[model samples]
Target: MNLLVTGGAGFIGSHFVRAVLADRLPGLEGASVTVLDKMAYAGNFANLGPVAESKRLDFVPADASDAPVVGAALRGHDAVVHFAAAGVTGIEVLLEAAHRLDIARFVHVSTGDVYGSIDSGAWTERSPLTPTTPAAAARAGADLMALAYHCTHGLPVVVTRGSDNYGPYQHPGRTIPRLVTALLDGRAAPLSGDGGRVRDWLHVDDHCHGIALALLEGRPGEIYHVAGTVELTERDLTGLILAELDLTWDHVTATPGHKTGDHRRALDDDKIRRELGWRPRIEFSSGLATTIAWYRANPTWWRALQSE
Candidate 1:
């Protein structure tokens, strides 16, 4: 079987590529994997470094918005784990792929940001989508488009919406990485407001694991939410990082945040657990500790991205 993974060079997508090439799929037929990425600011070649020599891995430098390239690449592939998008942009191009591409399964990686800020409670698959950001709105558009294809033409597309993802190989612009990198350098992380904003944070491993489970067990046209059990305020989380390194809250500070989504992000994930028997193994506290240790070891790794 052949797998075509869009955004394969990205944080989560690269992990998926690594899993497939590592032969993680047992009892599966032959495997040939192709990764199509636009090499955008978020896509990094370093993420795919480990699988560079794998015979099953094929890297195609392109954007998912380009239909012809994606169409040609879709030929002869058995499945597609669609992670490519203007991510926060939530573009509507994939609706075209549902009918145009020949694949057995279409797995889309969506985000909880699509649900907007929960304000006071958690959201479920039954929850309504009230997106406030252009990026998230684009994701909603594409997700609905994929499902429409399923309803209209029997296209087998399944979408997974997840919480904030963190850990190794993340672009510096994100939350946890930026926080850790900043604290390690004795610098203040430009945070949003009082940093009291709450979010459901998941390890990158868990996010990819959830994606993997969806690939194997998800039903057609289904939407699953992958979430960690913990919901933390940015202040509390940043404090944890500082405390781990034996620093005080005064050691780091905050700034205004992008008013794109909700001040908080919380989602209901019981469906993925009941349906796929999936849950996060790494606790947020421990994951943050390990993430801090990794940065302490690689000093210059993310420093280069500070100017960005």
Candidate 2:
């Protein structure tokens, strides 16, 4: 298969590309990949360094919002696994181009944040979207557009909504990496309010694996949830990171006025597991340790990004 992946230089997209090239993802062995990335602040070419030399890999540094570039990139690819979230414009452009090319499958990567905060219980594929943040609202709009194409034009779209992902190469702006990087620099990590925001933590590798399954086998116009292996509050997660680094609460400082929206987020991933046999293989404990070790050993990578 020849796969064109948008935002392929970013954290989750790069992992999918590396896995495809290395034959790590099942059903994608020996598949060639064309990566279309804008190379934005979050997009790092270094994330693809391991698979750079593969003859089957190709890289295009261009914005997904540019129609001419995106249309040209869509040629001769069997499917598109879009991870770019520049805006709804980019998604519409990709959808139009794929529809023109009659692409086999269009995997629109989305986030569980579209469901907003849930007081209790988990959100299913049938849940109504009630996005609060600008980013999530845009993503929710894009998801609807993708499904509309399937319904109106038969574009064979499959949407995968995943929970929060944490792994190496994630931009330091995110919560896990932010905390890990600060602790590594011997600086205090900031906690918002009481630090009790709830989140489901999915390893990036497992998240990508679920994406692959959805791309290969998911039904048209259907939505699948790729949930995390563990659920915890921000305070508890901070404690784990501190324990891993042999540090204490002294390294953590609470900011009184800061507020991060969404008190809790949880997803029911039984659909993907039952339909596609997808399950998260990495445990939170080991994944956290390895992620911290990665940051410690690769200060040059994260530090350079942080300095920019």
Candidate 3:
């Protein structure tokens, strides 16, 4: 199959690209894949290094917002994996990709943050979207637009929102890599507000596998929540990493965080599990160990991108 993937250089995008090319998808051996990315500060080409010269992979440095560029690239492709757009850049780019791409399926990659924070219960598929960030707000608009295309233009579109994912090739500025960087450097890893905020963490490999499933198996106009099995607070999560390092909580130190994001964030994956028979394969503890090992083995890959 020939697939067009946007944001192919970013963490999750690159993971999906590698999976398809490495023939992890059954009956998809030797699949031809194209990666379209803007290579912004967050979308680094280094993430794509492993697949850069693969016989089945191609990289197109283009913005998804440019209609003609994306449209021309979409021609004759089996599907459009739209993982592009600013994770925090907001909805404008989301609308642009939908308008341009015409393919069998437009798998819109999204985050669970669009549901905002819930104090009492988990958000099901029918939960009202009350996003608190500009990025989530824009994504809501983008999700609605993709659904509209399914209804009006008869485009096969599926939207999947998942929790924060961590694994190899993740940009160092993100939470997991930041913590790993500090641990490796013997520096006081930064934590905000005593690490009270909680997040549903998924391994990137699993999350991208869910995306691949959504592209191949999902029905049009449906929404899927690709979540992992664990939800832990920043404090406990940091403590877990410290334990792996044979250190204590005192080894880490407190730092302030952006006041706007959620104090607790998690998503409900029951719908995806029931409908698609998909759930995270990597357990939280194993995922943590694997992530730590990945950082340790590939220090040069991550350390070069460390923040000042």
lDDT of each: 0.79, 0.94, 0.80
Clashes of each: 5, 0, 1
Per-candidate TM equals: 0.92, 0.98, 0.93
Model 3: lDDT to the true structure: 0.80
- Which is superior by TM-score, 1 or 3? 3
lDDT winner, 1 or 2: 2
RMSD to native, candidate 1? 2.3
Scored against the true structure, residue 6 in model 1 reaches a CA lDDT of 85
- The lDDT, on a scale of 0 to 1, for candidate 1 is 0.79
Give the alpha carbon lDDT tens digit for every residue of 1-308 in model 1.
78888888988888777877777644342578899898887787878888899888888898887767777877888788888875422224544554666567888899987888877878998888888988788888777877877888888888999998888778778888888787777787656788878888888888878887887779998999998668888888887777888877677766876676588888889899999988788987788888888778876657765665
On lDDT, who's better, 1 or 3?
A: 3
Task: Judging by lDDT, tell me the better candidate of 2 and 3.
Answer: 2
TM-score winner between candidates 1 and 2: 2
In model 2, which runs have C-alpha deviations exceeding 4 angstroms?
256-260
